[model samples]
Target: MSMRKPLAIFISALMASSAANAAEVYNKDSNKLDFYGKVVGLNYISNNKAEHGDKSYARFGFKGVTKISDQLSGYGQWEYNVKTNNPEAMDMGNATRLAFVGLKFADFGSFDYGRNNGVLYDVSSFTDVNPEFGGDSFTKEDNFMTGRAKGLATFRTSNFFGSIDGLSLALQYQGKNPNPHKSEDRRDGNGEGWGASTSYDLGYGIQLAGAYASSNRTDIQASDKNGQTADAWNLGMKYDNAQLYLAAMYAETRNMSHYGISNNRYAKKTQNIEIAAHYLFVDGPAEGLQPSLAYVQSVGKKLDPVSKSGDAADAAASFKGGKQDLVKYIEVGTSYFFNKNMYTYVDYKINLLKKDTYTSATGVNTDNILGLGLVYQF
Candidate 1:
């Protein structure tokens, strides 16, 4: 062909190739990475008005998955809190929560390590539908359950026995650093513990799950007893649909000591049972609303009264109270979700049925609490 003809054909081909390349980039972007974050702020009133305050937190996160091959791929997630506010008071800048890194192996399992909520807290969250505020709501996550340890690690399975589809198992390991200054700090750098849990979806929007975990600490002290240890476990079930959800959970804690002459001496136990329900509605199809309610009852038997005492020794002295059947709490809470990412909540709790109080080592009933707040999550 003539040189001029060849040059014209080349220019046309180049234009067509550019258009094709643009189309390919748009289509292949399905595998591209992404990032997301949220900031939540709210003000609330408490039973003791003096305890009322504002709550705000900033969350930043990143997630991505790359397909290495047909049956193999890589996935990861990193999330950190940019802001932590004081709900007990009008203070800002507290501590970052839930910062972790996870790796996934398709069809195999996944491993995650770093600062993450404990398995106990995870189970509690799975059951609670109501929003939480400061120390008033059970869904706020008790210190013993939500606190993160430094040497924490978790592993989860992709599936179970090739059947029971959508079923997975999670194993967790946490190292504790017991600080003499902290009252409930169970993270002992020397003491460590591990646990495993199994969960499965039954299809049709329903799920069943259960988990058992036990941790032992060497420097643990109870009453006047040193080398004290505790074991915990949780069981739960859930049902869900486009309209409603029902969840129930049971958890227990048992204490043991090695110094005591009596085999079961210095041994104490605490049990918690909770139930929750959530309902969803479409006001006009364009807008939606979700409402939820939950109740929790905690009972203790032969519980060491020392738990409430700031002094470990004092708490230990109150450990064995007049009646082993002492100490209990009943709580109820509700929340309304205006949308998937924003909501408001209210909660009431009674620390009734106490065999002893901090003032009376023998036993005493405590005060009640009421709380209301709002939250937004992304």
Candidate 2:
């Protein structure tokens, strides 16, 4: 009788535990998971010295948020490419983009640890369309944080200070991996960086935003040689209405240092300013036809460095370092929306610069591009 009583007690505890576990999963107000991604097809024809690599690709991602309590929760995202040319993939060679997990508290803020966008890229997003697929904008020209691979851990705080009416702040930590080269290159090893930004909405589809970032790393071995600290900063504003949209961004480079090559180190500091605006002409006269026009300009300048170098090579290569004299672009495109989540576009872009230093055609010489593409989002 005594043994049976104990057995009954154990069974009851097991049932209670199982019930609690099931309740958590099917809870009325728990954290939830969402999936999002897109498939992209592109046809790029360059009028310059570059070649067109036409292809189709898709990306898939998952995001989840779970409520731990009334004031705290956990969130994470994992994203990767579904299809791509083997060598065309970016980051980790996995076709995977970002994989990170973090904790979130209502008024305290959030912290994430894993592979993610650098502070400069995060800040850059505030300035322009961030056309990962390719568009002509100033953010696209900066080159420092444009196509970057960074391994990092970061944290962000909520708008406790009310710096802006609706502002939030975040800090990032990026460690530099060293190249087994010279001592000047050694300083680039085990580097660290940080950033800050604020975003606010002024009502009626208008917003203001800004961001900054810096990093130190070993000079990546390349044609141009020199190793020094590298960093960038940017500020931008954006606005949108039913028929028109505008975006502008300004960025500066402290040194000509990136991927380990610091050739223009003492040459000069640089800045890039870009602006783009689009106006809708037609909504949908046909079942799937909407047209728009966009204009983009990318401008740059070199500032005198604090140090003076008498070498003629220093004077010539240091000032322009093979970047570009200037670039301006105009585009007119039509978007056919299948629904709210899918569309196709054909945009013809023209370069208005007189210089031929930068060309898209490698063997040939052209300065224009006609692109046709389709996009599907979820």
Model 2 lDDT tens row, 1-378? 122333223322321221111112223468677766677887778744344566567777777788999988998877777545335445333455677899887777788887666556554553343222223333322233432344566777655443445565667776655543465442223345555655666777676666676665444422223334556676767666534556666766654322112322221345556665544333234544545554544443442221123242443323323444344666666666555456688877765655332221111123677778888666
Per-residue error (Å), model 1, residue 174: 2.2
lDDT of 1: 0.52
Worst 10 residues of 1 by lDDT: 18-27
Model 1 spans > 4 angstroms off: 1-33, 47-50, 66-72, 82-93, 133-149, 176-190, 220-228, 256-267, 283-287, 305-338, 345-377
How many clashes show up per model? 14, 18
Poorly placed runs, candidate 2 (over 4 Å): 1-29, 47-50, 82-94, 130-148, 158-164, 179-190, 219-227, 256-268, 279-327, 353-366
lDDT of 2 at 5: 30
lDDT score of residue 357 within candidate 1: 49
TM-score of each: 0.69, 0.69
lDDT measured at residue 77 in model 2 versus the true structure, 0 to 100: 73
Weakest 10 consecutive residues of candidate 2 by summed lDDT: 15-24
